[model samples]
Target: MRQVIVLGAGLAGSFLACRLLRQGCHVTLIDDRAPMSASRVAAGLYNVITGRFGSKTWKAETLLAELDAVLKDPFFQGVSQFIHPIHIYRPFKDVEEYNQWSGWSAEPAYHQLVKFEERPLFPEVIHNPLGGIRILPCGWVNIGGLIDRLQDIFRSNGGVVLQGSIPYDQINMGQKTLTWKGEPLGFDQMICCEGYRIRQNPWFEKLPVQPNKGEILEIESEGLDQLPFVITKKVYMVPGESGRWIVGSTYEHLFDDPGPTEAGRAQIEEQLRLVLKVPYKVVGHRAGIRPTTPNRRPILGSHPQWPFLYTLSGFGTKGMLAAPYCSRLMTAHILEGAEVPEELRITQFKAFRPT
Candidate 1:
């Protein structure tokens, strides 16, 4: 069997490792389990129709199908607890916006993905004066729970799991050999899925990996938990278990730190107040740095100089929606010598070219 080492145990790494294992590779997965990692803090919201204009996500159909297959894999059984299916209610800003959605919903492209609502669905708790559109096949994944289960599954299948960071300085790489901290690791290849921490990698650091910081808040309200669906406007409000609700996510392309800030909290609360009519108490606050790309596409494929070193990252806020499909592509490329699409390849960036 081919021997491989996957660095970083976030959503990207975990998915890739599982895919590689199924391909009959002996895989070793390592993670530091850092505090406030993106996967852990992410709302894990997956929606086909997103953004201010409500455009369909790129490759939504294929991505969703791959996600379904991954979730149904017998190896990942009992992961249903992390999957929460719910529609997303996007409030219309005005009559013109409502008209736009009504027109789009009639088209074959959006016939099943979206539906326009002429009357306000929840006037008592929401500020939707002009009604909204309900987006189907949208829901939130408990990323932390899913990762934990995946790790357990990996271990149960005889894959090795190491808990700790791998120092870049201690890593020694050659044309056909690799070692960590002066000890040889007899692996055929190494794939790095370190997310925003990719900046620390010497080989893949040149690729355009922008770090985007985002913050989220958890609040407790009296009857808000009764809402069985997600609400969206300037921000999203996802209802969790019990009376707790998740409200957030402000994108900061430029930030001095990655930790939660009072300013971020204030911004989240400001947006939350605009949509939520009920009073709530802030129970939790979190922040994480996402590895985003300028083109908003994931960067995959191997290094130019070192073919054995590959990278699969930069999914940004859509990691949960994209990881499953991308992992399969990475696995095929590694084992079957398949080609990665140009748009998702790391070599598309000028910095990725070999000297």
Candidate 2:
């Protein structure tokens, strides 16, 4: 059996590990954190329609089909993977931007799903000036719960998890072993799924890492209990279980600290207050850095020289949509020598080297 070691048990690592395990591979997954990752902080929104200046979501339709297929697979039964249509109310702050996306995605399937009929603003509850339309086959992921369950499933299947930091310098290519906590573990291949931390990696020193810091707040409110759906304006209000809701997220690219910032907190509150007419209490706040690449595409593939070295990260803000698809692709490339899609290949980095 081919042995694989996955570094960083984040969304990419955990999901990919599960796939590999199902394929009957011996796997060891590691992460410094106990369990939670940026995935935990994410609202896990998967939208087929996205882009600011009017660009199509990268392979969203294709990915969503795969996600739906897996959820229905007998192997995934009892996992309770639920997917639902999420209605997005994006009030066109920039009409020019809205017009730009109007003609994009000429695909027949996408065109069929487009509903030209909708209200500009919600009649009740809130206000919208620019008008909004809805997108289908999009919704949230139970990421934290998914990861926790994956951990249990992984351990039960004889998969190993070493929970602690594994320094990149400790991987001896010539020796083909990783020394973690003074224990030397050998594997056929090592795939680093470390998120923002990979920016400091020497081997991939040139991989563009635009650390986008995002903050989100969970709140409890009364009279807003009617919101069983997702709402989006400047900020979004996603319905959580009970009377709680998730309102977020402010994006700051140049921030140094990953901790929740007072400015970000205030910004979200202001946005929430504007969109939400009802009173709400801020119950929790959290933040994390999204591992965005310069090109905004996931970085995947094996090192040209060191075939044993690989990576499956850089899912960016769309990890929820990107991870599941890319994980399957990465596993296929590793196992069957399948060609990595030109779009996501790490070779897109001209300056990257295996050594």
Candidate 3:
């Protein structure tokens, strides 16, 4: 069996570890239990349609299809209490946006993803005066809960262990060998799924990782109790159980702290006002850093200088939807020598490598 050490127990790490475990690898999953990870604060939303222009997301069909299959698999079913699939409703901002959506909704590519012929006008509970489009195969994942369940499952199988993060300097990745703490470690590979912390990873600091801090607010609003689908306008308002909605998020590229900021809260609140027609009380606030890349593709593959050292991070805002598909690809690449898609390959960025 291949021995593997997967770093960071967030979305990407958890998915990669699970895949490696299934491949019969002896895995040790490490995490520092930091709140700085994107998985922790991520809304865990999976949307096939995104952006102001309503363009298709990267590999949405493949990723969403895989997500549907995996979420139904017996193994995933047992550990996926944190997952729930719901449709999404994107409110048309005006006549221009409405015409655009109406035009696109009829196209062969988008017709299948929609639930309605024309844009549906929601009830007065929501402020969708210009109507909205319903996007199917959308959902949210409770990542923290998913991580805990994954750890339990991994531990129960006796093939995986969860431990504190390892010191960076302790790992010496040679072509044919890996040593930890000045001792030989019998692992075929070490995959780094270090999330936002990837920017600080000594082996991959030059890979063009930009950590963006995001904030969200959970609010209690009885008026929106009937909202079964996620509502997106200025900001997304995801319906939660018991008359609650998760409203967020503000993206700040150059933040000094990962914690929620007043400015971020204000920004989210302003967007919330624009979308939500109901009065709501803020019940909670959260913030975390997202591991975004310049081209907004996943940063994956092995280090050029050390083949044993692999990276499986930089899923960014789409971690919930992208991690599973990317993890499968990464596992196949490591075990079966499958090809890593060029967009996600780490070597695409021709930057400096530490000697």
Best by lDDT: 1
Instruction: Pick out the ten consecutive residues of candidate 2 with the lowest summed lDDT.
Output: 112-121
lDDT of each: 0.87, 0.75, 0.80
What TM-score do all the candidates reach, one by one? 0.97, 0.90, 0.94
- Candidate 1 structure quality by residue, lDDT tens digits, 179-282: 55566667788999999988888888777889999999999988685676899889898887555788889999999978999999999999888898888999
Candidate 1: 10-residue stretch with minimal lDDT: 174-183
Residue 327 lDDT in model 3?
91
Task: Write out the backbone clash pairs for model 2.
Answer: 120-131
Model 3: worst 10 consecutive residues (lDDT sum):
115-124
Clashing residue pair totals per candidate (backbone < 3 A): 0, 1, 0
Regions more than 4 Å wrong, model 3: 116-122, 175-184, 241-243, 352-355
lDDT of 2 at 94: 56
* lDDT of each residue in 1-355, candidate 3, tens digit only: 7788888889888888888897789988878888767887878788999988888999989998888777787776565567888899888878887788778888999887875425445455777777778998788877788887877777777655645656776665654444454665667788888887887789877777788888999999778877778988879988764456788888888878779878888999888787776788999899988888888998778888777788988887898889889999999999988998888887777763334
TM-score of 3: 0.94
